[model samples]
Structures are given as C-alpha cells and as structure tokens.
Target: MEQTEITEILNRPYARELLGRDLTRLAYVAADGTPRAVPIAFTWNGAQIVLCTTRNSPKLPSLRRNPQVALTIDTEVHPPKILLIRGRAELDDVDGIPEEYLQMNGSYRMSAEQRVEWEAEVRSLYDGMVRIVITPTWVKLIDFETTLPSAVEELVRQRAERQNA
Candidate 1:
C-alpha cells in the first residue's frame, strides 16, 4: 500500500485509539515453520511501532530469519475496532532498557510506590534489550462503521445486489 494511504488510515480516530492501547498481537513465522501470535506491549512512535524484549527472546531468531510480520491492535467490545498492520521487523540491540519500553509499560495502572519497584525490578533484570522496530508498509482499520473485514465487505455488497435483484 502507498505510504499516504497508510498514514491516512492510521490517522483516523479509531486507529489512533488502537495505537494508544498498550498491547498488540505480534504475528510472525516461528522457527519451526508454524505461525505464532503473541500479545506484547508496544509503542507507536508516529513513524514506527516499537516492541522491546529481552536480548535472548526466542522470537528474536525467528524474526531475524523472517522479518516480515503483522500486528493487530483491537478492542474486545462488540463490533470491535481493529487496526491491522504489516511490516518488516528491524532489530536494534540497545544497552539498558529502551525509553519506549518504559513509556509503553507506563500505561499500566500502578501506585507510585509500585511503579518505582517495578521499574527497579525491570532495570535490574535486563542489562540490555532488543528493540523490534516495524515501519508499517500496509495498514487497514476496521471500525465496523466506516470499514470492515474485507470478506465481510464483499458479502455486504453481494447481499445488496441480491436485494436489488
């Protein structure tokens, strides 16, 4: 998809809400040739989606082998709002916790004391982390209002045709 189209979709209010959400399902091919989708914390930095993980994360190898990935951020409410994104993962190894990691996790509800303890624990546990960065190449937003899943859209069109007939 064109960059402009992606930007427009992402700029939509619903899509922006999904992007503000803390969790997204990162989907990629596993090393064993199976598809894997796992919930991970992420931050959307205007131009890229950044997910931080341990340096030794199992998904690291798989991502290195196949950088292509898809991410889904959606709501659980009826007639859900979903933002789907496809991109190529670019791994960046950085010393210490990435700011994006801290920023993303900050959304979780925690008391000030609890937040301090958690930050300490996180800092002490990992000396470095890998930033799994993805610059979205394609995007789709399904609000079930202005948009929907492609198959559902097609079905709606067919139903309309039948009604007209």
Candidate 2:
C-alpha cells in the first residue's frame, strides 16, 4: 500500500489503541521453512515496529534469511479490534540492553522497587540484544466500523443490494 494510505490507517483511533498495546503476535518463517507465530513485546517508533530479542535467538537466523513477516495486534474483547501489518524485518545488533527494549517494556505494571530490580536483572543477564525493526509495507485496521471482515463486508453489500431490489 502507499505510504500515505498506511499512515492514514495507522493514524486512526483504533489503530492507535492497538499500537499502544505491548504485545503482538509476530509471524515469520521458521528455519525449517515452517511458519511460526509467537507473542512478543513490540513498540511502534513512528516509522517502524521494534521488537527485541536475545542476540543468540534462533529466530534471528530465520529473519536474516527471510525478512518478510506479519504482525497482529488485537484486543480480546467482543468484536475485537485488530491491527494487521505486513512488513520486512531489519535486524540490528546492539552492544548492550537495547533502550528500545526497555522503552517497549516500560509499561509493565510494577512497583518502583520491582522495576529497579527487574532492570538490574535484565542488565546483568544479556550482554547484548538484537532489535528487529519492521517497516510496514501494508496495514489494516479491523474495527467493524470503518472496516469489517471480508465476509462481513460482502454480506453487508449483498444485503444492501437486496434491500434496494
């Protein structure tokens, strides 16, 4: 999709709500060519979606080989709000705990002391991290208002035609 179209979709209120969320299901091609989807913490940095992983993560190799990926951020409530994105993953290896990781995880509900301890633990555990940055090539927001599922949209059209007939 065109960048302007994508920006319009992403700027919608429903899309903004989904983007505020901390988790998304990251779908990618596994090393053996199978498809895999895993829940991961992500942050939208205006232009790109950022995901952090251990430097030695197995998925890194797969991502490096095939950067194409899809991500879904959705709500569990009835008539769920979903933001779907298709993007290319770009991996960047950083020397220390990535600030993006910290920023993405900053919303976790924790006490002041717990937050400090957690940060300390994270700092000590991983020598470095890989930031998987994804710039969306296509985007969709399904809020059942301005947008609906494909089947539902078709049904709505058919119903309207019948009513007119």
Candidate 3:
C-alpha cells in the first residue's frame, strides 16, 4: 500500500481505536521455519508499535532471525473491528526498566500496592529488557460493517453480477 493509503487507514477513528487496544497478536516466522503467533502487550506511538519482553523471551530469537512480522489488533464482539499491520521489528536492549514496558503494563487494572509489587517483581527478575519496535509498512483497517475483507467484497460483486445476468 502507498504511504498515503496506510496513513489514512491508521488515522481512521476505528483504526486508532483498535490500535489502542492493549493486547495484540504478533505473528512471525520462527527460527525453525515455522509460523508463530503470540498475544503480547503493546503501545502505539503514533507511527510505530512498541512491545517489550524479557531478554530471554523465546520470541526474541525468532524475531531476530526474522524481523518481518504482522500484528492483528481486533475486538471480540460481533462485527469486529480489526487493524492489521505489517512491519519490521527493530530490537533495542535497555538497561533497567523500559518505559514502553511500563506503558504497556499500565492498562492492566491493578491497585496502587499491587502495581508497586508487580513493578518490583519485574525489576528483580530481569536486569534488562528488549524493546521491539515495529514501523508499519502496511496497515488495513476493517470494521466489518463499513469495510469487509477483499475476498468477501469480490464475492458480493460476483453474486450481484449473476443476479443481473
């Protein structure tokens, strides 16, 4: 998709709403040449998606081997709203805690005391974390009511043509 098209899709209210979701599924090629998808917490920084995980995360090795990835942010309700993104992952190792990691975890409903304990546990577990930044090259916004999948749209067109014939 052209940059303009992608930008327009990303700027849409529905797209922004989907992207704002705290959990998204990240899909990538594993080191063994198999496909892998995992639910992860992410934050969208206007133009890019930021995700953080431990240095020893299994997904890290796979991502390093294959930077190309796809992310799907969607709702569970009927007529779901989905934001599909394709991007290349850029890894950054940060000492101490990563701001993106904190932001990603902030969406969880936790009391002040629980939050403190959680942060302390996280800090003690890992000396550093890796930030996986993805700059989207393609973005598709699908609100089933307003926009259907391309295959479905084509099928509708075909059915209409047959009826007209």
- Highest TM-score against the true fold, candidate: 1
TM values, all candidates: 0.99, 0.96, 0.96
Candidate 3 error regions (>4 Å): none
Candidate 3, position 86, lDDT:
98
Instruction: Please report, in order, the local distance difference test score of every candidate based on alpha carbons.
Output: 0.97, 0.95, 0.92
Can you write out model 2's per-residue Cα lDDT over 71-161, one digit (the tens) per residue?
9999999889999999999999999998989999999999999999999999999999999999999998999878998889999999999
- Give the Cα error of residue 146 in candidate 1, in Å: 0.8
1 versus 3: better lDDT goes to: 1
Residue pairs clashing in model 3 are none
Which residue pairs collide, candidate 2? none
Clashing pairs in 1: none
